[model samples]
Target: MSTADNNSQYDKFPEVAIAGRYHEAWQGWPQVVAALQEALAAQPRQKTVLVVECYHGVAQQELLKALILPLRPAALFDAADARRSTAEIEALIAGDLTDDPVFGRRSSLPLAAFFDPAKCAQMQQAIAAVSHGLVVVAGTGAALMADGDLLVYADLARWEIQQRFRRGELGNYGADNARADLLSRYKRAFFIDWRVLDRHKVPLLQRADFLLDTHQAGSPRLVSGAALHAGLRQVARQPFRVVPFFDPGVWGGQWMKHQFDLDPAAANYAWCFDCVPEENSLLMRFGDVRVEIPALDLVLLYPQPLLGDAAYARFGAEFPIRFDLLDTVGGQNLSLQVHPTLPYIRQQFGMAYTQDESYYLLAAEPDAGVCLGVKTGTRPDEMMAALAQAAQGEGRFDDARFINRFPARRHDHFLIPAGTVHCAGAGSVVLEISATPYLFTFKLWDWGRLGLDGRPRPLHLHHGGNVIDWQRDTDWVTRELVNRVEPVAAGPGWQEERTGLHPSQFIETRRHWFSVPVLHHTDGRVNVLNLIEGEEAVVESPSGSFAPFVVHFAETFIIPAAVGAYRIRPCGRSLGQRLGTLKAWVREEETPC
Candidate 1:
């Protein structure tokens, strides 16, 4: 079917694009290629262009022929070769030459200059003149073309390289000069770095108006970043800053040192008086949104107690809630605990609390498992009795009535609602998204472990009992053990419900696997795109003009709200068929007998 006809099927959900880099030899490339082909086939012919930037080798030439030749003869133009003599490019721009005498009858699309700022400006002028056509720019060509008029940027390098180039580090080849030109050129940008973007400094590159990230695609990063950026952009004309959080060394991996110069010890968890004294918190404040919990260190980074008075004056009026990236390193099973809802927090703690949260499993050891809720048929009285016995040291009640206990595998996601008794298993790392600013926890049990300080970790038994929903309810948690099991029919870029387990909070969660041109949301909520397991994809939105970004394994990205629409195009091989056995297991359990 035609692209428009296919896209009509997924009209309900917002559109998003995935873009990144890849090597053909990687096992994931097959899947990436398949997905890209599908997206292209389903996308409107006029609206889609498979833009690829080659660093070296004959791969670019082969890939171009492989992708474009079979579909239709594409209008090809080389930015590098086009600049062989500045005179030729000028002649084309001046409309004196109807056809490229050098390349013969094949249509020579407008060639943009890379590295030369003046030529880059001329190319921008030429593109603005063309109402519609397929144009491909590669290498430095992509960056120069990124002068800000394109709607999407698919960056292939790590965030640091992009940052360096934006910071005038790439030989100062007038990097700052190019940036000044880009400031007004694009509206939104997306990166492959899944960690939270730093709000403290100026953004390295603002080429993207809307960014679609492939890192940790399952979390709330995109939506959160969008909201913060939009708010900050509105209040201040300064550019949003991008900060790196993950250190490869921590994961036993090696990354170039210059990518991000992060000194965990140097991070100050104090308030700065220069901004707003009362509302000061170490958490980096962008605009209305403040990220208090450091994703890497798991510490409160902003709004110190000393600044509480000012914080109250600035934030107390709106009572903004907080968001955290709760990290657990060792395996001591988290104390079985519960968080009081908003009413309870306000009544008991004398402060408002927003407790909604979703968990995205980062990494886990083979033995890690979590204890969630109670088993079916376990009566409330039995649970209460177990609680009492455990409190009195009369029984091993913690393990007996637990309803569901399962190993924590990599990438597993779980939603914990208020009043649900839950505990993170040992040897697992997770990204926790929640409503902010309350530290209320009621612990039901701890493995009798001691803290690093040679003391038993403190327990909040009295309060824990208050929030425990004694009634075992498994209705809210739905588990999808596998990814992309049912082959969704190919169509225009769209989102489909990959699993029945959906989040019930103000935010709704959906897993979509698409190979089509898609548009993103304009609503205020952030869109977090995690590259759970894929080759490469691109997210094009209305912010900056089209630029390239990379998405590798285990990385995450945040797409901001200012981006009006988005599109996704696969870049590498395809991810293989679903994990068959895992799919069966989940289906059997979710299916009502």
Candidate 2:
């Protein structure tokens, strides 16, 4: 479990050491504690016990201890002791927990259900008993209150929680196959947490008297009430930008390393989760205090505003689009894989939707290409047999003979609908835009490479075989999956080109090339955009001006549907060169599923 420390950016920021580790945390916890003290002072009760509620694995309980120990609360209710049995949680790993069709219904149930009923009653009794002395209630779901009580929400980024999971800080529920074993499980749990915790958020925010952002866990940001309201309103209406996070992988590339000025000490940067809200964070700065919350909070808080009526109708409260970078520039091909179809994923994995992805080639070397579908005449059974043989180390795979290969260059869009076999070959930087359903990829081959842990990577031959759409052979892939691009329209110094849709796709894509500022309307669907071929650009909207949000080369950004009309203009050196942007949105007709 000794993986590389992913967040080397901490070296450039002020850091504090806690729990035998150093982290890039703002030195703001004291301010938040002071605010809590002030808020408690106004309670006019001698027994002022603050209830700290947070997402699971957020180290806020430690923070609460540090903040409250000096006051010597008469009773400290540590709610962790009330957690449900691990066996019970593991038993329900594959059961749907929420009624929401698309999200909040996968893997383990929500943490709210993780508490033992008896322990919960005990905790409630403890809250009731505290009247003349100080009492402190702290943990996930600890702020479920009685009459006249103080509540505080300790927010943490889902990405940070996932990182902690990777470090084995969270308990293992038998997902020890690889480093990414719990990735999907964590995502599923997070969606449920959003449902379980978010309904109480508005009330908690308005009445809590204190709000804490503990993204770093060691240090928390305290926002004043006025500033919190302003920040929340801004987030509700403006274009949303999650704090981008990077991780190194077995097939990672160096393109992002050189482009984003990231820490180069690492071997390479693999995935830049630029705007996948479920696994990314949004830093909300209020005055000198800041708080980091899951980007999913926006969609949960303002479903119609952020995703619009059309998107909300289609995907419920979920943000349906995801944009991330898959860099193979100095590495190897991504695993030969096929995502499950919607039905297949639901039946086999308990997920509502499958990963329907598209690789928009942002840059590639001359020999770089994509391996897509199967060769012209390869049978589905034959491919499955070969995959089984390879998985068992029986023989070498003639990938060229078995998989169709096509040369890819800048701006090439390859549609990867579910069940299509594909992999982005080396020497390319691919901006993957697709449905938000990630972590269902059924890897068939890994070019005989071992993972970072020195173990052979896991392959889902049995599962993959069940889902491969064998008919998507070479001819169909070349003629259809490889996008059929055509100019759609043009305006002053700008033009729109439609990246043709594959018949199986639910998302529509297009690229905009402009030398001067150009206005684009969201038109009621969230837009996932990337500056595929530009140095930088400005994104301004009627809702608010995010001047110099300054998207650099290959950086992904999002425009929430709440920002109805927005303009993008070339910045820096791109003023002289035509700035190219690739964007994807849910198709209008496909929005009512």
Best by lDDT: 2
Which residue segments of model 1 deviate by more than 4 Å? 1-330, 350-353, 362-368, 379-397, 407-411, 427-429, 474-495, 498-504, 515-517, 535-538, 542-552, 568-593
Residue lDDT tens for model 2, 459-543: 8787788888888898888888887888999988999999855767778888999998988898878888888776778787645
What ranges in model 2 sit over 4 Å off? 1-27, 92-110, 145-148, 172-208, 224-226, 542-549, 590-593
How many clashes show up per model? 98, 1
lDDT of 1 by residue, 1-593 (tens): 22332122111111122122212111123333443455455655553443333221112343445433444423443445323354443343333222322111111232232135565566556544544444444432443443322222222222333344345433211122334422111111111011112221113123233222222212111112333334333322111112323322111211111111222343211100111111222123333222321121111121212113333334332223222223344324556777776566666644444465555565577886666766666676667667667666675665654656766777666666677777776566554544443335566666655544355545666666666665535543333221212443334544444332223333334445555544445243334454444444555544654444444333344433334355555555433322110000001112356
Candidate 2 to truth, TM: 0.87
TM-score of each: 0.42, 0.87
Best by TM-score: 2
lDDT of 1: 0.38
Worst 10 residues of 2 by lDDT: 9-18
